[model samples]
Target chain A: MSDLVSRHVGPIVLDGGIGGGAMESQIRFTGTAVPLRIEIDFPHRMNESVVQDIDTAIDSTDYTDRLARQTIAAGVHRTGTCAAKPYASWTAARGERPADPTEFAGALTLRRMIIFPDGGRNNPERVAMIYSLPDTSDEHPIEVRFLQPSGPELCPVNVRPRV
Target chain B: MSDYDDLGGLVARMKKAAIDCYMAEDGFNPHWNDNQKYAKWGWAYHHYARPDANGEGGGSPLTATTTLEAQGSVAPRFDEIRSTIDTILTGWDTLPSGALCRAPQSSANAATALLGGAASVATVNDSDEIVRATETAMASLNDLAGSFVGPVYDKYCAQLLTVTQNLGTVYTILEAQYAAQQAMWPAAREDVVAICTSAAAAWEGRAAEIAAGARQDSFTVVAAVAGAVATVATAGVGTAATVGAVGAFASTTVSTLSSLDASGGHVSGDTYAEILASLVGALGALNETIAAQELELNRWLDETLNAMSTQLADYNLDAFTLADFSAGDGSSSINRTDTDMITTAMGRVEGALSEALRAAGAPPVSNPTPRPHAIGVGLAGTHLAASGVYDYANQCLQSTAAEYTRGRGLFDAAVADYFNTDAESQLKVTTLLSQEALIAEMGGRG
Candidate 1:
C-alpha cells in the first residue's frame, strides 16, 4: 500500500486456524458525517467437516503468497481478500484411477466472511458481511474486496486536484 | 483614502521662483552691465521730469509742455508725445509706498565730482535746475529691481488662491473618508470575532464525545484535527491526551465510513454541520464589509480627482492665455495696457531729450558720455528691466500650472497603487472565508 492508502485504509491481517473460533479483520475509511467501519469474519473449517469431492479446486500457497500473487495497484488498489489463509488441505486416497488426485500439498480452501453492524447509511454501528464463493477452479480464484460505499474515497487522489 | 501629500514640490517651486527673481535683479538690472551710462541718463531724465528753481528740481517739463505747445515753443505733436511718455512712466514706477528703490550712489558720486569739485570737474550746469532733479530719480530704481514678485503675485493672486483651496479640499476629503473607514472597522471586527468565538465553543462541546469514541464517523477526522489543535495550543505539553484522540477519531471515522451503503445518501445533523453553516454566514458577511470599505475609499478618491482635474484645467487655460505679451493684445501687463503704449512713450522721451541737447548747442553723441546731452539712455535701460518683470511673471504662472498638473498625476498613481494593494488583501481574506473554498478544503459536502 502507498503511504496515502496506509493512512486511510487498515493493513491486511490474516490468521491460520482450525474450525473453532472465527477470526475478524476491519477495513475502515472516512465517510461524510461519520466513518463507516467494515468488519469481516473468516470461519475456521475442520477437515472432516469439509465435503469430499473428486475434482476439488485448491491452492497450495500460504496467505502471503495469495496476497502477493494478486494484481494490486500500489496506491489505491482496494482489491483482494485482505485476510485470507489456508483453511484445510485435502489429499486423495491411494490411486485407483489416472492418478492419486493429489500433489505434494493437496487441495486447499480459503474462507472469507463479513458481518455488518447496522443498516443505516450514517450509523456508526454499521457492520457488513461478505463471503466469496468457495468453489473456485484451479485456473481462477475468488477474493473479497473492500469498497468505500459511503461516497467517493477522499484520498489524496481525489482531494489534491483542487487548485 | 489618501495619497502622498508631500509639501516638497510646492516648497521647491517657491524656492525656484525666489531664486530666479533674485538672479533677475542682478542679471537684468539696467546698471548691472553699464553702471556709469545709466547713472548719466537717469540724471538727465530725472532733471527733465522735475526742473525746479532753488535747483531742488520739483517742476516737471512734461507739465509745461502743453504751455510750451500753445506758445509755439514746441510742436503740438511733441507736446502730445511728451504727455504720453509721462503717463507711461507714472504707471511703470507705481509701486506700493515705502517700496525699496535702487540707491543712486553712482550718480550722486558722479554729480558731486562734477558740480562740487576742482575746475576740471565743474560743468556749465553747475547751478542748473536740470542737474539737481537728475540726482533724484537715480536714488529710486533700487526699489524697481525688488518689485518683481510683488506685481507677479498680485496678478495671479485669485488663481493661486483657488488652487490652494482645491488642494486643501483634496486633503480634507481624504481625511473624511479615512475617518469613515476607521469608524466602521472596529464594529465589523468585533462582530466577526464574536461569531468565531461562538463557533469555537460549539466545536469544543462535541470534542469530549469525539475523543471518547462515541459517534465515530468522518466527523471524527475533523475532531482529531481539533484535538491536534488543542495539543498545539498547549505547546506539546498535552501529547498523551492527543494520542487517544487521534486513535479513536481516526479509527472510528474510517470504520464508520466504510459501512455506508453505496446506493444511499445521508444529510448530517451533527453539531459540526451547524458550525459549518454559522461559519459560512459569518465569513460571507465579513467579505461583504471588506468590499464595501474598498468601494467607499475608491469613490472618494475618484470624486476628489474629478474636482481637482477640473480646477487644474481652468488654471492651465488662464496661465496660457495671459502668457502673450504683445502690443496687439492689451494683456501686455497686469495693468492691461497695449505694449505699444510703453514703446510710444520711450520714443517720445528719447526725441524730447535729443531736441533739448541740440537747442543747448550740445552736438549729437554716438555713445552716451555723462554730458547732459545723453538723457536718451535711461528709457532703454528702464524698459529692459520692465521686460524682465513680464518674463518672470509668465514663468511663474507656467510653473504653477505644471506643478499642479504633476500633483494630479501623482494622485492618480497613488490611487492605482492603493487599489492593487487593497485588492490583493481582499482576495486573500475572501478566498480563505468563502464557503466554496471551505467546502473544498473539508473534502467536499460528503
Candidate 2:
C-alpha cells in the first residue's frame, strides 16, 4: 500500500537564498556551477545609469514568508535575463580584468544583481553573482540585467522539488 | 620551403584541419586552448544524445592517443569516459532499478540507510526483486557504452581518419628528406605492429615448450596403478539372478566383482581436486601477462606521442602555405629546422606523457615485466634489465628517428581509421545508450 509523492516547495531563488533545504541544495549543486555571481541590494539600485518609473514600481507579492518563495522567484527572473541578453560589465574588482589572456591561464565570470529600493528612496536594488575558479585565469564578465515590469508583476517560479 | 614567413598560413591551415578533425567527431570545435574556438565549441554542447551506430573508437592503439603535432582531437572521448564513470557511480546510490533511472531515493524517506538508499524492498514485493536488479545492471551497461563510445571512442576515430588520409602528404616529405640525406624512405608504421606480432609469436612458441615440459614432468599424469586379484574365482554373471537364484548374492565370487571394478581404470576421487588445484595455480600466473600487455601499450603511446610532437614542432612548414607553418613553444620559426621541430615535438610529447600517465586505465606501473632471459640470473637481474628499458624511454625518445617515424605513421593511420570506424562505432554505442534511456524512461526493465 505504498505510493510515490511529489510536493511543491517554494519559489527557487539565486540571490540571497531563502535558507531552506531545497534552496540550499539548488545553490550548491546547480548554482555553484553556474559560473556567475548575483547580489541584490534590497530597495537601492547599484548603478544609476538606468531610470525607473516609481508609479510603475509596485510590490504585488506578500512578504509573509520572509523570502522563502520571494527570493527564488527573483533568481529565476535574473537567470531569464541572462539567457536573453549578451552581458557587458566594467569589472573593477581585482582578478576581474585581464592585461593579456595568452599569458594567463583562463578567466570568465558572471555577475548578476537583484535590485531593491533603499528606505525613502525610489532606486531599484542589485544582486550580483560571481563564479569561476582561481586556477582558470579567464576574465570574461557577463553582467545580468533585471527589468521591473509593470502591472500585477509575477514572481518567477523556482522549479526545484522541495525535500 | 625552410622560410619562416609562410608560417601564419600554415598554422591557419593546420588549425583549420585540427578544428575540422575535432568537429568531425562530435560537431563541436572546443579549441580548449583558445577562447573563441572554445566558446563556439561550448555553444554546441547541450547534453544531446550521441549518434547511433558508433561504439566510439577503433581497436587500434595509434588511433586512440593524439600526437601533439598531429593535433589528435581524441580528448573529448576520454572526457566522456570520465563523465560516464562518474555518472555510473552516481547511479549506484539507489535501488538497482532507481540507479538506472539516475534517480536517487531520498535519504529522509528511508529509516536507517546512510546513503540515500532507495527503499526498494519497502516499495515492491519480493517477486519483483530480480526484475529491479536486472534493470539496474542494464543501466550500468548503458553508462559504460556511452563513456566508451562518446568522447573517447570518437576522438580516437577522428585522429585515425586524419592520419590515414594524410599519408600522401607524409610520403612526399619523407621521400624528399630521405633522398636529400642519402637515406631510405621510412617504412610504414604497420611495420612495427608486424614486428610486435612476430615477437609475440616467438614468445608464445617458447612458452608452449615450457608448458609441454610442465605437463609431462610436473603434472605426473599417472602413478602406481592399483588393482588386486582374489582367489575364490567363480564363473558367473556376478550378482545377477538366474533360474534358481536363492544363493545368487551369497555365492558370487569376490574375484569376479573385483575384476568388474578393475575393468574401469582405478583412480581415487581425491585426485580430481588436486589436479584442479594445480591447474588453477598454473593459470593464475597468466593474469600477470594481461597486466603486462596493458603497461606495454601505455608505454608505447606515451613514448611515441612524445617523440612525434617534438619532431613535427621542429619541421619546416614554409612551403605548405604562403605562410610559414612552423609552431613552437612560443618560439620563433625563423630558424625552424628539423631539429627544432623535433625538439618542439618532444616538448609536446613530454607534456602528453605526463597527461597519459595522469590518464585512467593505465596499465601496471609498480609491477615490472618479469624477464625470461633472467632464468639463470634470477629475479634481481631481470628486474634491472626491464627497468633499464623503461628508464631509457622515460626521456621521451629512446626510440630512434626511424622508430619514431614508424610509430608516428602508426599513430596517424590509427587515428584516421579510428575516425572512420568510430563515426560508425559511436553511432552504435549511442543507439544502445538511447535504447537504455528509452527503457529507463518507460521505468526500465523493472
Candidate 3:
C-alpha cells in the first residue's frame, strides 16, 4: 500500500571516448551522492533479431508464448535486492523507448535490470542495491553514463559481464 | 543472274537449308528473312560453335532475339529456332560483354536471357512450333537445381571479415591505453611508439607475406591467423604490441575481402577455371559489404533466381537437350558436391587454424593473458591513467567490431540475395562473431 520509493543517482560525467572503449573509465560523482557502481546497459546483439520475432507473435499467441519461454530458458539471469532490505523479486528486462524519441526514458540498451529474491549474492547482479536497465530496442542509445545512488537504497546496476 | 544476285541466291539457299535441316531432323522449322544474308541460327549448337566464337561459350547476343514466338513470329521455323537457342543457353541467351566471362557467370546468363527479349530464357520454348522446348527447360532446371545453396556461407564469410577488422581496431585503441598506463612510470611516447609501431609493422608484414603468397591458385586464406602472436613477438614487440600487429594484419585481410564477387558465383573443380577469371569480382563484392552497412542484396538475387526458377520449372529434357546435358557426364554434379563439401569443411578448419596460428606465434606469455582496465591513483590523476591501457587496447577489439559490422552485413546480404543461399550468409556471420568472442575472452584474461 506504500508508494514505490524512487531513488536517484548519477549525472556523473562520462570520459571523452567513443564505444565500449571508455566503459571502464572511472566516473566522478556529485558530492551528495556516494560514488556507486557504474551502470552500463550494453546494447544486446539480438535487438534486431528479436524485432522480427515480435512481429511474428502478432499472428499466433501460442507461438509467441512458446518463443518467449524458449528465450527465457536461453537467457542470462539478472537479479537484484533493495539495499535497505534484501527484499527481491525475479524481475524481467525492461526497456523504455518512444514510438518517437525525445526523452531519457526514450533511450535504452539491449541489456536489462532484473530484481531477484535477494538483490544478488552471486549472480549477474553484484549487490542488493544495484540493478540495470536492459536495452531491448534499436531506438535505444547506449551510453555508459555514471550511476550515482541516493542514500544506499539504489546501488550500482550490473551493466554487463566482464570483458 | 549477276554475281551480286548470285550471292543473294546462295544466302537464300543456305537459309532454306537450315530451315530444311530443322524440319527434317526435329519436324519443325524456325523463322528467317530469306532476304537477309547472314546465318542467324544462334539456336543451333552448330551455330553457337562457329569460328570467331568466344571460347567461354558466350557471345554478343543480337538486339532482335525471339523466344518461342517473340515479334509475333510464331511460325514453325521461328519457334523451332527459338526453342533450340533456349535449349543451348539454359535461359541464358545474352552475352553482355563479348570479351570476358561475367562476374558470377550465372548472373550473366540470366542477363543474357533478359537481353534477348525472351522475357527470360525459360520462355524460349513457349510454343508448339519448337519440338524440344520442354527438353531445353528440363536441362535448364537441372542446371539451376545443382546451383541452389543455403545462406550459411555468406554469413560465415561476413563474420570472418568483421572479426578481422575488430581485431585491428582494438590494437590501435589499446596501444594508446597501454602507454597511458605508464604515466606513474613516466615513459616516452617515442618508446611507446617504438613498441607499438614495431609490433604493428610485424603483424602487417606477416599478413602481407601471406596475402602475397596467394599465388595463381590455392589461397592460404586464414592459415596463419592463430599464429599471429608469435609472429608479432619475434618482431621485437611486447604482447600488447603484438596484438596491435595482429590486428593490423587481420584488418588488411578483411579489407582485401570487401572487394570480392557479390553475385554468389558457383565454383567447382570443372568450373574452377571460370571462377578464376571471376575472382576479382567476388572479392570486390566482399570488400563492398565489409565497407558498407545498409545492404541491398535481395533485389539482385531475386532478379537472377526468378528467371532460372521459372524456366527450369517448365523444362521437358528432349533428345538433343539430354545429349548436351549428359555430355557433362555427371562430372559437373560431382564437381559441385565435392566443392560444396570442401568449402563447408574449410569453414570449420578456419577457426581452429586461426587459433593455432596465433598460439604458435606467441603461445600466451607465461600466464594466460588478461585485459587490463584502468589502474588510476584515484579518479583525478592524468599520470594514473596508464594502468588500464593494456586492458583498453584489448577491449578495443569489441569496439572495432561495432564499427566495421555494417560492411560485413552488406556483403553478407549481397551474397545471400545474389544466390538465395543461406549457407553463404551463415558462413560469414558465425565465423566473424566467434572470432570476436574468442578475442574478447582472450583479451579479458590478459
Candidate 4:
C-alpha cells in the first residue's frame, strides 16, 4: 500500500469534444511519488449506472499499467485515460460553466488517473484522468497514489530522451 | 710540237677547275662572276700554293703576254687545290665514319632531349611553358635540317627533316593535352566543392534546429490558460455561486490549456532528434559517393597516363629509326641496333612514368556525379507509428527517437569518413599541384 500525501492539487480541467463545455476539479493525493496513479471511488450521491459507465470508461488494470509503462519507456508520453475519446466527450457535454453545487460534486468523481513526469517546475506533472466531471464548476476530491517508479524505469527520464 | 700543245690544253683546263673550286667554297654567284669566276679561282689557288708569287692580273691567265709560262705556273697550284677538294669530298662521302656524322647525330640527340623534356612536363603540368619550349626546339631542328644543301648532303638532310618533323608532332600533342588538363582540373574541383559545401550547410542547419528546439521548456497549463482566455462572465448565478463557478472554471481552463500546450508545438524533441538522425544518414551516403568518385578519378588518370606513355614511346622509336635511315650507309643492321637502343630507353622511361602516375593518384578529367540532393529529406520520413489512433502521439515520439539514434550513428560514421577522405584529397591535390609546378619549372629550363 502506497502512502497518500493529501493536499489541494487542483486547476485540473478536461476540454474538447462534441460538447463545448469543460470539467474542473480539485484533486487529493493518496500517495507521493513521481507518476502518481490512482483508482477513483465515486461518492454514493452520483447515478449508479453513470458511475458504472465512467468506471468502465476509465478502468486500468495491471495490463494497462504495464502497457502505459512500456509506452513511456519507449520514449513516448503515456497518458492513462486522457487519450480516450469517451472521456473527452464526457467533459464537453457538461457545458461551458460549472454545474450547481449539488451537481458539481457528483460530476467531478474520478474513475482513473495518471500524471506526466514533472517538467522541472516543482509542480505536479501534467495529469490525465478519466472522471465524471459534468460541469466546469465540478470539484471532485479524487484519490491518487504514486504509481511506483511512476513511468517505465527502462525509459530515459531526461527532458529529451533521444538526446 | 704536239706534246707542247697538249700540255697547254691541260694547263687551261686546270685553271678552269681551280676557279670552279674557289667559287664553290666561297659561295660566289655563278651568274654575277661568270667572266671572273675562273680568274678568281686561279688567283686563290696561286696565292695559297705559292706565297712568293705576285699573281694579281685581272685578265685570264691564258691571255697573258707570258701566257704559256703563266699557264705552266698556275697548273701545279690548281693541282694542289684539286687534291684538297678531293680529300674534302672523300670526307663527305664517308661521313658516317667521320666527324661530319656528328652534325646530324647531335641534332638528332637534341631533338630527342627536347621531346623527352616536353613529354615529362606534359605528363604533370598543364601550362603553356611546354608548348613554347616545344616550338623553340622544333624551330631549331628545322633550321638544322635546312643547313644541309647540295646533292651530296641530300640524304642526311632528308633524314634530319623527317625526325624533326615527327618530334614536332609529338610536342603538338603534348601541348594539346596540357591545355585540356588545365581546364579540366579546376572545373572538376569547383563542382566537387559546390556539392560538398551545400551538403555541409544543410547538416549544420538541421543540427542547430534540433538543439534549439530541445532546449525549449515544455509549456505548462498556467501559461497556456493565461494566454488562451481573458475573462469569465457571472451574470445569472448568485454571488457565492458565481465565485465557486469562477474558481472551478479557472482550474478547468488551465488543464485544457495544458493539453493544448503539449500538442501545439511545431516539433517535439523526439522529432527533432529524428531529423538529426536523418542528417547523419545523408552524410554517410555523401561520403560514400565522394570515395567512389575519387577512386574513379584515380583510375581514369592512370589509364590516361599509360596511353600517353605508349604514344610517346612510339614517337621515340619512329624518330630514332628515321635518324638511322638518314645515315645513308645502307647498314640496316646498324640501324636496327640504334632502334633497339632507343626502344629500350623509351621502355624504361615509360615504365617509370607509369609508376609515378600510379603513385600520384591523378584527378579525374570529368566531374563526378553529384550526390543525391534529397538524401536528408528522404531519410526523415513521417515519425508516426503504424498502429492504433490512441497510440499515434506516443508512437511518433518512440519512432522518431529510434530513427534519430540510427541517423546519429550513421552521421558520426560519415563525419569520420569525411574527415579522413578530406585529408587524403587535400594531400593528393597538394602533391599533384606541386609536381605540376616542378614540371613547369623544368619546362622553363628546357
Candidate 5:
C-alpha cells in the first residue's frame, strides 16, 4: 500500500483557505496570468493487482465526477489535460496500456487548472502549479487536499473610546 | 552724260561741285581714299537746302567760267544739287549749331577714354560707358543752350528735337513780342544784347539733338550686330566664320565714318566738335556691347575649366599606384591589400570621370553597384576579378567622351564670342581715335 501525504503547493495564509484547514493554503498568484498545471504522479512499480485496481478507479465515471467536484470546491477549475509526452522509449508505458503493458518509473499526468479567489469560476486570477516527487522513499503517494476559509475573528474587549 | 542719268551720277557731279568749291587746294588728288577730304562739303551739298554752304562755299555760281549766261545756266543746277543733298542728308534747311557739334564730341571723347580705361582694368567686363557718356553730353548741351536771350534762343530750343512743337510755338510768340518791343524802343542796347545772347544759346542748344541722334544711331548699329551674332551662333557657324562676320561689320562702320569725315563741309570749331562727339558716342556704345558679350562668354569658359580642374584634383591619380603583385605567394587566394588598393583607385577614377562628363555638359554617369570583396583566389584569378571590376571605370570614360562631343557646340560658341567681341572692341576704339585725330586737326586749322 502507498503512503499518502499532504504538501503545501504554494503560499500559506493561516485563515485564508477554503473550509479553513489550519495547514491548508491556496496557491499564490504571481507574474502574468496563465493556466495552472496540476500534475498527479502514480507509483512507477506496483503489483499487477494494485495497478489494475488504480487504473479501474481512474477510468470510473463516478471517481472522475468526484475529482472534478473537489477541485471546484477548492476554488480551482480544471480547463483541459496537458499533451502527452512524445512517443519514445521512456514515455511508451505512460498513461493507459492494457495489452503486454509495462509501467514507467514514475508516471505524471498533467492537468490544466485555474484558481479564482473571488468566487466567479468564469474568471481566474491565478493559474499555475508544479509537482515533484519527494526524494525520500517514505514520502511516496502525494495527496491533493482541500482548504476552507475561517469566517471572522472575534475580540472580547468592546469598550468604545472618545473621539 | 545727261544730268538726270542716275542718282549716283548726279551725286558724283554734286560731290565734284562740293570738292571744287571747298577742298580744291593746290595739289588735292581725288582718290577713293581722298574722297574723305570732301565728305563734309558733300554732306552739306546733299543735306542742306541753303546754297551758301553756311559761308563755307568759296564763291557762288561755282563755275570756272564767269560769263553771266554761264553762271545763270549753272545756278539752277547747283541749287537743284543742293536741294537733293539736303533731302538726302537732313531732309530740312539749316544745320545744327557749332555748339551742338562741340558738346557731343567733347563729352563722348571723355566717356570713351574712361570706358577704355575701365575695360582694360576690369576683371569682368561690362557696359557702363553709354550711360555716363549720354549724361555728360546732355549736360554739356544744356549748359551751352541756357545762355541765349531772344529769337535765336528760341531756335536753339526748337532744335532739341525731343522738345514739344507747342514749346516752339510759345517761343515763336515770345520772339514776336520781343521784336515788337525792340521796334518801339530802337536804341535799347540791352534788348540787342539779349537777342544776340539768345541766338548763341539757340545754336548751343542744337547740341542736345545732335548728341541724342548720334546715340540712337550707335544703339541701332550695336543692336543689329548683336542680332547678327546671335543668328550666327544659332546657325552653328564655325568660330572663324563668326569672327569674319564681326570683322566685316566693324570694317563697314569704319568705312562709313571715314567718308563722313572726308565730306569737309563741317564748320571748323564747334561743328567738328559735334561730329567728333557723335563718333565717340557710337564707338563707346559699340565697345560696351562687345565687352558685355565677351564677359559672358568668358564666364562660361571659366566655369567649365574650373570644374575640370577640380575634378582632376579630386581624382588624385598620383595616389593610385598598383599594389605589389611581385610578393604574391604561390597561393590561390588574392592579397586583401591589393584588392583594397585597386578598389579605392577604381572608385576615384570613376568619380573623376563623372565630373569630367558633367563639365562637358553630359549626363552624369550612374554609380557602379558595390560588390562584396571576393575571397582570396590565387594571383591569376584575383587579376581576372580586378579586370572585371575596372570595367566600370572604362564605361565612365566612354560616357565622358560622348558628353564632351555633345558639349563641343557650347565651347565653340564661347570661343567665337570671345574673339569676335574682342575684335569688334578693337575696331571701334581704333576708328574713334582716328576720327578724334581728324577733328583735332580741323580744330587746329580753325
Candidate 6:
C-alpha cells in the first residue's frame, strides 16, 4: 500500500464550482507545493445514501472495536456552507484570519467521490470513492466535505467506465 | 584564323575549368567547409535528447570520415586529364614546320648535260620517278599534319568546351547547395536547442509532481482494497465503516489522477531530432544531385575521347613516311578521358534539388543549363536511379534518426501507460466498491 506523508498547512475552504454542477474544496499540505482541490458532486439520492451511511457508521451502536468505529466517524464531516454561494463568499471564508492549515499536525487523507454512469439495465454504473491515507496518521480524521451540488444532474458529462 | 584561336581558347578554358574543379570553392571539394555551422548542428544533434540532469544518455556527434573519403575521388581525375592535354599541346609544338624532309635539289645543270651527251631516256625517266615518289610522300606528310592540327583537334576542343561548361555547371550546383546548407543550419540548430532545453527543463520541473501524484493514486487504491478485505473478513461487522473508508480512498486516487493528468512529465525533446532529420534530408538531395552531375560528366568525357579518336584515325602517319612519327597512337583508341566512374548510377533530381534549395533559402544556382548537354551525352532519354551520395549524407541520416529516437518514443509510451494504469485501477476499485454495496444490500442492511 502507498501512503502520503504530509501535514495540512491550511484550513479546509470551499471553492466555487463549474456552473453549480460540482463543488470544489481546497487545502494545502506540507509535502506538496500546490493546494489540493477536491471537487464534489452527486445525485440527491446518492448524497442522502452516503450521508446516512456515515450516520450509521457514527451511530452509538454495538461494536466489538470502538476505536476503529470512531476513527471512521471523525474522518467524515458535513458542511452547512452552501456551495452555490457567490464566489466572493467562498473567498471571504478562506481569508478570515487564516487558520494555520498545519493546526492539525497529524496524518490526513483527502477523499474524492467518483460516480460512473449507468451503461444499461444489465450493466449498472456504480459509485466508488478513494482515500489518500497517510501511513503515519491512522488516528487523524480523514476529511470529507459533502457539498450541496446545485446542478440539474450530478454526474459529470460522459463519465466513462474504462477512462 | 578565328577557328585556330577558338581551338586554343577552348583548350585554355578546359584547363581553367579543370583547375577550378580541383580547387575547394569551385565544386570538387566534397567535405563541407562550414565548421561553425556543423559545430552548432552537432551540438544540437547530440544534446537535444539529453535530459536536464547530467549523465543521461544523449546523442554523440557523428563523424565525417566518410565525407573525407570523397576528397580525391573527383579532383585527381581532373588533374590527370589536364596533364594529358598539356602533354598533347607540348607535342603539337615540336612538329616539323616545313616539309617532312628536303627532297634532293633538282640539279638542272646535270640534267641538261646528261640529256645533251647521250639523251638517255631511261636516266631522265628515272629522275622523274624519284621526283614523283618524293612529291607523293611529301603530300602524305602534309595531309597527316592537316588532319592532326585541324579536324582532330577542333572536334576534341569543341567537345572539351562543352565538358568544361558542364564542369562549371556542376560547380555552380555544388556551390549553391553548400551555401543553402550554411545559411539554414545555424538557425535550425538554435531553434532545436531552445526547444529541447525548454522541454527538458519543463519535464524536470514536473518530476516532483508526478512522483507525489503516483504515490497518492496508488495509496488510495491500496487502502480501499485493504479496508474492503477487512470488512469482508469480519462478516459485515464493520461493513458500513469499510464502505466509507474505501469510498474516501477511491475519491482521493481519482482526484490525484485528475490533477496529474497532462502534467508535462511525458514531454520529449524531439524538436531537435526533427530538425536534424530535415537537414539530413536536404543533404541527401544535394548529394544525389552531385552524383548525377558526376555521372553525366563521365559520359561526356567518354564521348569526347571517342570523337577525337575517330577523327584522328583517318590521317594515320606511317613509321616509314616520318621516321620519328608513327600512326600507332592515332590507329588505336586512347584511354578514356576519365577512367574513374564517380557514380555507379545517375538520375535527374532537378525538382528535388530545387525544392531543397528553396527550403534552405539558398540562392538559385547560376548555371544556365544545369546538367548541360545531357542530351548530347546520351543521358537525356534515360531513366536513372541513384542512392549513394558522398557516403557522408547516408551517415548523417542514419545517425540523426538514431539519435533523435533517444528522446521520444519511450516517454510517450510511459505517459500512455500511466493513464491506462490509472484507468484500470479506477475500474477495479469501483468494481470492488460496487460489489461491497451489493453485498450490504443483500444482507438486509439499510
Model 1: per-residue lDDT, tens digit, A24-112?
A: 43332122121223232222221211111000001111222232223111211232222121111211233443322122112323332
Residue B211 of model 6, lDDT score = 21
Q: Which docking class does model 3 fall in?
A: incorrect
User: What is the lDDT for B137 in model 3?
Assistant: 25
Cα lDDT tens digits for candidate 3, B1-446: 43322333332322233233332222111212221211122111111111111111111222232221222232444344334323322211110111111111222222222112222223122122111222232233234322122212222232333333222222222222222122211111122222222222332332232222111133332223223222212222232232223224334332432333323221112111222222222222222321121111122223222322233211100000110111111111213443344333333333322332232121112211111112112222221222232233223323332322333343334334435544444444444444433433222222
Alpha-carbon deviation at B25 in model 2, angstroms: 62
DockQ of each: 0.00, 0.00, 0.00, 0.00, 0.00, 0.01
Query: Could you tell me the lDDT of residue B77 within candidate 1?
Result: 31
10 residues in a row with least lDDT, candidate 6 chain B: B339-348
- How much lDDT does candidate 2 score? 0.24
Which runs of model 5 end up more than 4 angstroms from their true locations?
A: A1-163, B1-61, B64-273, B313-446
Best by DockQ: 6
Separately for all candidates shown, the number of backbone clashes (residues 3 or more apart, or on different chains) is 31, 88, 105, 9, 43, 16
Q: After superposition, how far is residue B254 of candidate 1 from its true place, in Å?
A: 50
Worst 10 residues of 4 chain A by lDDT: A154-163
Q: Encode model 5's per-residue lDDT on B321-370: one tens digit a residue.
A: 12222212212222334333323332333343344323222111221111
Model 2 per-residue lDDT tens digits across residues B260-376? 321221222113233222222222222222222223323333433343344322211110111222222222111224323333343343333233222211112432323232121
Measured against the true structure, the TM-scores of the candidates, in listed sequence, are 0.21, 0.13, 0.16, 0.22, 0.16, 0.18
Ten contiguous residues minimizing lDDT sum, candidate 5 chain B: B39-48
The regions of model 6 sitting more than 4 angstroms off are A1-163, B1-145, B180-187, B197-446
TM-score of model number 6, chain B: 0.18
Write the number of the candidate with greater lDDT, choosing between 3 and 5. Answer: 5
Off by over 4 Å in 4: A1-26, A29-163, B1-273, B314-446
Which runs in model 3 stand beyond 4 Å of their true positions? Answer: A1-163, B1-150, B179-184, B188-341, B344-349, B352-446
Native contact fraction per model: 0.00, 0.00, 0.00, 0.00, 0.00, 0.00
lDDT of 6 by residue, B137-178 (tens): 233323332112222222222222232222222222222222
Question: After superposition on all CA atoms, what RMSD does each candidate show versus the true structure?
Answer: 46.6, 42.9, 43.6, 53.1, 54.7, 41.9
Comparison by lDDT, 2 against 6, better one: 6
- Clashes by residue pair, model 4: A4-A30, A4-A31, A11-B251, A21-A95, A98-A137, A107-A132, B19-B41, B277-B407, B280-B411
Q: Is the docking of candidate 2 incorrect, acceptable, medium or high quality?
A: incorrect
Model 3 score (lDDT)? 0.24
Computed on alpha carbons, the lDDT of every model, listed in order, comes to 0.26, 0.24, 0.24, 0.27, 0.25, 0.25
